[model samples]
Target: MIYVVKNGDTLEGISRQTGIPVWKIVYDNQLSDRNVLVPGQALLLLGQGETGEVSGGRAAGGYAYPFIEPEILGQAFPPLRELLVFSYGFTFEGNLIPPPQDDLWMVETAWNNGAEPFMVLTPFSGGAFNNQLVKVLVGHEEIQENLIRQMLAAVQDRGYAGVDIDFEYVLPQDRAGYAGFVGKVRRAMNEHGYRVSVAVAPKVSDSQRGLLVEGIDYAALGENADTVFLMTYEWGYTYGPPMAVAPLDKVRQVVEYAVARIPPEKLVLGIPNYGYDWALPYERGITRARTVGNVEAVEIAAQYGAVIEYAPIAQSPWYTYRQNGMEHVVWFEDVRSIEAKWGLVKEFRLSGAWYWNLMRPFRANWLLLS
Candidate 1:
């Protein structure tokens, strides 16, 4: 069972509530400061030895840029079966534009760490993802075939186990066109003994709308590809209001809706490995939140003497502190919060979970999933 830290809650208080001892709570979460219990921390009522032995294997993957920090990359590779190298873009003329950063090192690193590296194919032109570029490629039969031909060849040359098609920001009119493109890619790749996966924006229903989400037809994509990765995080975003990155209530709604349309086994729930810090008073058009790793968030709480607080409804940890004559609010994930996510995987009997990108160092998450 998971226990949420309430106001005025102590280790002994939690012990009495759950009938577990104070030492057990301390050991499970690896609490460095036992005396300082903050509101909203989720406590897993199990010991270190007990967790891994029982919860060892669950299918998991993570996205990573070609240039990952050496220290952060070392701890992440062991936990993923597939590390999606982000990404390989395509041109309007049907030529593959590979990642700017060399990915040979990442491919080799995945192999050394017992993971099967996969290539991420995206629709990009010049620099960023272009909906017009996607519409042009998918609209023409010859261009689609040409792109797939090059993609398969690249996969063969790189020794990638498969590909994850992550075409983003597609227009609403291009929904069926994009779905057809995915189906063609899957058929061609499957013939070469390569699997294809697709990432879809999270939605609670077919009627849900926002931020280029209309282009996603969840049911169609689920049938087209080998698996579907639900982009479940980022309800709180860079330009959005302060909130949980992946609020539990919101994530559950997406998963519930997805399973009704797609097979539960084919869904990989996406979790955020990092969080954002927003300077208060937030401005609608101008405010931008700087990204921070989960471990770093806690350290900042300690450094500034800010008490970390949790939102029960969101199942997320956050805190407020003043620095340089400015107030800031941070919402981030911890062991308790992630364990709640893990429970959803079991509750739904879904395939597994994956992180957005493994750039940050979150040792507790590494320990939990490892």
Candidate 2:
């Protein structure tokens, strides 16, 4: 669970309210001064739970919707054992809708293929960070109750075996609220015989505070949600400096901290089937958010006549090409990088690994995991 410090809220008050040990919070963030917490800071609240080995071997999974266009769904279903539906959420104005038509086909195809369909829910589209939405969906009592009811109804009507809530950019203050939301959702889904899961940021400790890390209360999620999916990708991304998609050390830091709070069996590591190419001489104010999947990125490199180079630290492939005399760096995942990440999943004994939006056709990724 996360505790965002308000202007007047104190660590003592938060600790008292949540029943979390104060030392753990301080130690998790590695703070030199315990008394200093910004207004939007996030703190993780660890709870007692099962800890140890996950004996299961690596398993394959995919994210999709059942209602994709006939051609798309037909092309997508033959790949794997698990199909994760995109979402079911109220719009910004607050009206509940079913998954998109394209997604409906994807979900149906997974079922027909004898694959389990997992439904993922989010408050925002395109993975933007939204704190106010998190507060309303999780902090506000009325909204939380309504969301839980709607979630249960959707799972039953759609015949989903499991539900994955992927709420991102939550405010620091809504830490407990998010935890409460997970608890309520879990209760509603479990009573109805539905599996409940949550998507969390990759963090090693509970006290970590950053816009991305603050929103996810890893410990609370570990205790409340049936499965905690750690997004272990994007170490190298479009908006940030050029780097590998999922570096080995960064992933390990997240897993090491996560296991201390969550059971290894419930952890689902995220694998990136994608990569980013950043234009050099980067401008601060300008936006550079073009991210490409592995297949597309590889083709882009070939098109530019860019020779691919490998980074041992990142364990991913990259190449620098000049376009109209401007320097650009492209970072992408390949067989070697995917294998390194998969090795981490095996070492951690995680429940499984999930890909982010299987919109791209990366044949090699499936082959490597299979």
Q: Against the true structure, whose lDDT is highest?
A: 1
Please provide, for model 2 over 1-370, each residue's C-alpha lDDT reduced to its tens digit, 9 standing for 90 to 100. 4344566666677778877667765543334456655443334454443111121345557565544445534443344666778766665444465665645455566788867787788776554545677776664677777767776776776777878888877788887788878888888888878888898877776677787778677888888999888888877766777777788888989988888888998998888867787888767656484788676675665466666666777767788878889888888776557667777888988877887757665544553343
List, residue by residue over 1-370, the lDDT tens digit for candidate 1.
5566767888888788767788877755557688876555556675435443112477778899998986678776466678889999887889998899999888888888898889999876677778888889878999999999999999999888889999888888889999999999999999999999999988888987875688999999999999999999999999999999999999999999999999998999998988999999999999999889886787677577787787889988999999999999999998878877888888898888878889887655655675
Full-model lDDT, candidate 2: 0.69
The all-Cα superposition gives candidate 1 an RMSD in Å to the true structure of 3.9
Name the candidate that leads on TM-score: 1
RMSD values, in order shown: 3.9, 18.3
lDDT of each: 0.84, 0.69
Clashes of each: 0, 20
Name the regions of candidate 1 deviating beyond 4 angstroms: 1-56
RMSD of candidate 2 to true structure, Å: 18.3
